[model samples]
Target: MIRTGTEYRDSIRDGREVYVNGEKVRDVATHPMFKPLVDIRARIHDMAHDPATRDVMTVTQNGQTNAIGNALPYTQADWWAKRRATDTVLDAVGGIVTRVGDETVGEMWSLLDGAEALAAIDPQFAPNIKAHIAKVLQADPFHVSANTDPKGDRSKAPQDQDPDMLLHVVKETDAGIIVRGAKYETAAAYANQAFTKPTIANWGDAALSDYAVGFICDLGAPGLKFICRTGFATRAQAEDYPLSNRFDEVDTLVIFDNVLIPWENVLFYRHTQAAMHIRATLHRYSAFAFVQRSLKLADMLIGAALFNVRQTGLDKLQPVQEKLAQLAVWRESLNAHLTAAIVLGERSPAGLMMPNQSLLYAGRVLACGQLHEMMHIARDLCGGQISLTPDAASFRHPDTAPWLEKYYTINDEWGAEDRRKLLAFARDLLNSDYAGHRLSFQMFAQSPPFAHLSAVYRNFDWDGPLSLVKDAAGLSDRVLGAKTLTPGDSSLSKWFATETPKGKAAK
Candidate 1:
């Protein structure tokens, strides 16, 4: 049965062990910090039921319907079609939910599909993954994927890091394998059903035997503890903090205290090279989806920024118009890369059609830098109004009405109340913790701009261009090796050394 939003909520009502700040969260469904995020997740669930969105948000699985999301089967083009529908749902939500932090986990699951691709190499692994996917599809389960191992020193390998820093297999038994240590910055673990696949990013020869290990376990599984950080969301009231209220997706550090993963749930153990391959491939997929989402977000922000300019009567200002033009360029760049990726997508071995890695990586690099520029332009266009605007309560206050009406009212066309609401909406974006989080998110969304650029440079086909350049330079094997000078280069070099003029002659 396809779970509705209410059903998804009720499913979490059962007491599950989750710790936040040294205290166990008695109920995630009711917790103030978690509830709003759950509300967002519920909305996603509700989308599956909505007549308008249902077709796009749910998919039929083995004799059952599952919420179409990052986890939808993509083992074929038909699967890709379903995923495109899922993309439609995500785009409808805008950055309101999925582009938020926890949505990172959803994107991770899309990449996890690659693991299923790897399972095809071994029949034993294939069946285990298929079963897990089927079980999760039936319940519409949420999973948090941990890919980064906490290394005390950046230069050191996972094995060199305090074993407690990286999750490692400590004991193997007939029943399961015991893993200990912690994975850092795990988003949405508090509200998720399970955390799957803690794999090492980089490995060495000594680390080869323990290279990559992938498995799944429930959030309440014996030894897992969640340590959450206090953020803008956890500290503010819903009315006073609209941004935090709507979008405080919490990130946590999940410590596995000898957590046991049943043998059946173990997808890969000690296959280090395959593990790195999976991580890199997942990065490509997640980055592609993330860029797609970010472009949509940029579009929304651009609209809001333009609206702010028009609302404030600054639309005619040349400087403001120039800024808007720049924003349009940024938006176009983002969309172009996304469209390129889509058109150039290829079928993965796992049957999932994935975006071109080079384009996706390039898009992420552009987004990281361009988002900051766009935000700055938005702030500039809004001027001091974004920071100086009063809160929502001030508008409702009785005594301030006369003064607000006289001063805040800009054009006679827009009344005081209209102006106040516009300012409030703008403040909700500019002054809220959401703004701070967005800045942080954009800054660190990918590994790094340079890192992404490096990946793109590595993956791009430089050989084709190199061949063209070499041939143009008359350095190709056909000419250079045969000691023959190409006419173009030889003539150009000779002409450069000796300039001839009709009037000046030989001089």
Candidate 2:
């Protein structure tokens, strides 16, 4: 059955151990920093129950239609459907919320079904992992995949630094293995049912052997501690801060202290290559999906930017129009790349049809570079007004209202109070700390920009374009060197007009 927002909230009421700023949070659902985010998440869940969005947001399984939450396609057609569904979902929620939250983590768990299928290749671990996945599916459980280990020194390998810095198998027994170390920057682990695959592959040879371990453990499992980080959303109040209210689902560093992983829950162990393969494949698919999300976000930002310009009466200025046009170009370019990726989707060896990796990677790289420029344009166009806008309370104050109304109102058509509210909404878009966090998240979500660009340059089929150029230049064997090549071999050059040669007749 599709769960309502309230039902989702009630389900998580059980106290989970969440530590923030050296203090433990008794209830995340009630925490000011977490509540607005949770409320927004609940709204997403509710969308699945709404008649309009129910079909797009949910799928039938085990004789019931469960909220799709974040589960996407395993085939090319499925990928297209998933992208369409994702657009619907993001549009419904307003793009203020990033796709990397509880719902996203849960959807990642569903993708683990594919991982378990691969693990099944090893007869020993296959059945157990499959069973583990079955259990999770049956319960409609939430999971956060923790792969980023704490690299104490960026240059040092996991084994070179402290083995404990990376989550590794501390002991093995017939029942299972015990793991220790920390997983850094995991999103919403406190609210998840389990943390899957801590410490990504490539920790070290010794580190890799122990670190290749993968498993699912309860969030409240013994010795597990969630060390929360303060985000922009966490430090603000919802009534006064709408942006944080909708987007502030805090991410945390998860510390594992000798956490036990049952043998049945292990998908990979001591197989670093296999582990890396699993991770690489997952990144390929997941990153592709995230590009779709970034495109949707760009669309939202474009609309908001245009609205801001219109509100400020700069819509007709050629320079402002040029800025908006640039933003539109970035938005369209991203969408075009994403669309191409979807159209060229292919089937993975695992039978999952993922988007075209090259195009998707290009979309991601473009998103990183373009978003920064877009934000800069947004800030520049909005001017000092974004930062200096008076608080909502000031307009209501008897003493401040007169002066604020006289000077702050833009045009005669809009009142001082109305203008202030509009500015507040614009400030919500431009000046909020949530916007900064979102920018950083988008920047690092796929991979570093240079690495992404290298992947795109290496993977795209440049040979196709080069062949066209070769044919145009009469370099093809079909041309047979019948004529000497000139700088204007195909098209006429203004400086080198084709005149009848002294000895040869013009064709």
Cα RMSD (Å) per model? Answer: 9.5, 9.0
* Residue 260 Cα positional deviation in candidate 1, in Å, after optimal superposition: 0.7
lDDT of 2 at 134: 51
lDDT of 1 at 151: 58
**Can you write out model 2's per-residue Cα lDDT over 131-218, one digit (the tens) per residue?**
6545544454444556577667757766677788778888998878888898754445335455456444445555247767667666
TM, every model? 0.83, 0.82
Q: Please, what is the whole-model Cα lDDT of each candidate in the order they appear?
A: 0.63, 0.64
Write model 1 residue lDDT over 97-141, tens digit each, in one string: 443322443333443566655665444564666666666666666
Residue 23, candidate 2: how far off, in angstroms?
2.3
| Candidate 1, run of 10 with poorest lDDT | 498-507
Model 1, residue 283: displacement in angstroms?
Answer: 2.7
Off by over 4 Å in 1: 21-23, 60-64, 70-95, 99-126, 155-161, 185-187, 193-195, 198-202, 207-211, 237-240, 477-507
